[model samples]
Target: MNVRHLIPTAAVAGAVVLGLTALSACSTSDAADRRPGDKLNVVASFYPMQFLAEEIGGTHVSVSTLTKPGVEPHDLELSPRQIGGLGDADYILYLKGIQPAVDDAIKLSESTHSVDAAKLTTLEDHGTETGGDEHGHEHEGEGAGADPHIWLDPVKYAEVAKGVGASLEKTDPGHAADYRKNTDALVKKLDTLNTAYKTGLRNTATKTFITTHSAFGYLAERYGLVQEGIAGIDPEAEPSPARIQEIHTIAEKSKATTVFFETLASDKTAKTVATDTGLRTDVLDPLEGITDKSKGDNYFEVMQSNLAALQKALGAK
Candidate 1:
């Protein structure tokens, strides 16, 4: 599933330009301790990341999300207030390439010395494939690289959670021990969730599913399931008629019982495909937003809900 050709050159260019400007305006300072009446101000790209930060940081940190709830992350553009919030925060957490707008805000925050440029543990641009059923699509450029939905997979997310805990400890050494404790608890929860997914998805009757976009690569690979997406890496991509037809054929052949759509993105394509095939369409959230139907206002709950969805969709009794 190489998707390099699908990486929008214009988006990358815009991100680069914004990053440079933001970085240039930022000022760096020696990391300092939290003063009396100070709380660690943290900013995240979207709901999932923010939820993680809030869960781990607890009473010590105040976390905010740059992208509003229910908005497609790829289409997000920071408002003046959001940009200002980034500069005022003590730390900003985001997955690169997943949200270019947040990346730009991080760069800008660097210049203003409002927030420390946190070290990112996950290298997003790697070309490693989270192997499942390859859909034989030739992506030309960086889009063909690895999928950025690492948080959807519990194993990868545990690693990310650990990294975040480490970063939080570094930012506020006074709370290092507490951060480690929180990390351990969060990791345990994630481990339980991982076991649930493996137990639920293994031996399911249907191993292949259809999605509105290529956001479930990590989940599908982790659970030995395959995904056929109508769109590419960019959620906004409009599938060609032929591509849509091809997905229909693949879904029919794979015995796909459900067509999954994301809350933050359009469901028109998924609905059309489901209608044509007479299969049900359901929401398989990417954890990009906090929707009313989401299990709760957090990542772990959302992942749990997704596993339940998979179980029902695959007919895993």
Candidate 2:
């Protein structure tokens, strides 16, 4: 993807206002890499992007996330302070179309280096429902756009990780070799993860799983399974009566045993499906962010937990 350095009008206005307000906050020693010993200030939009930067930039970069733990990234609205902070980032790492506010902030800020992870690989539409199911509701502004949960597929994530490492190399050329080495290590780990998922989900009795949202399209597709979601791409979108009926029909036909909900999203819809049918309910986290309810601290651990949940729910022998 091309680097975006153009600031929109709104971003320009916000920056001017913030610049005036914070004129006395600190001296001109306000560059992203000001202090000689300071790490590269890498501003990431949310958890996945932050994790990638930390993994590749490891020790060489200081990564900060805009969305705090336990928060939903899609609904994030940046404060003026956060917007100003973007200006101080040596590099901005984000997936375009996942968070609109962050996209606008990147456009508005004059940050020297910015990476859009979405550009690293192809994004499939993976329409919310299939096989004669009714059209489910999507987020208002996100109609029919490509799914943003590419990180769920380890292969795709590894590709994005490589792109991030390349960006870091460009931004910090002195440590280019380190970035490349770290990128290779991260890709190897992701390849191992891909192998685990393939082996674990290969012999499942059924190839279908139900969920509160369509966040697992890439994962399911990668592992030869199908995802039946109550809602469309957006988890916050309420499932209509027709949509619920569709999912019920799918679950019964596929003999799906569980309705999976994610950590950051409410389980009410999944539970409702479980209640209507005789299926159980379980957590199939999307790993949008780290939360108190998350089974592990980082992306890899949570993904492994998710694999275990899928294996049980899919009745793998």
Query: TM-score of the candidate numbered 2?
Result: 0.87
Question: Per-residue lDDT for 1-317 in model 2, tens only?
Answer: 00123335476567546753564364322334456666888889999999999999998888899989987787676767777776566788999877776787777664557789999987877653221122343422234547778999999999999888888888888788999999999999999999999999999888889877667878888888877766655555567777667677878888789988888877777777788877899999888899889999999999999999999999998
For model 1, give the 10-residue run with minimal summed lDDT.
111-120
**TM-scores of all models?**
0.82, 0.87
**Candidate 2 colliding pairs:** none
lDDT of 1 at 193: 92
Candidate 2 regions with alpha-carbon error over 4 angstroms: 1-36, 128-142
lDDT of 1 by residue, 28-127 (tens): 2223745765777777787768877887888888877777776667777655556655545677777765665566556645533322222333434223
| Candidate 2 weakest ten by summed lDDT | 128-137
lDDT of each: 0.69, 0.78
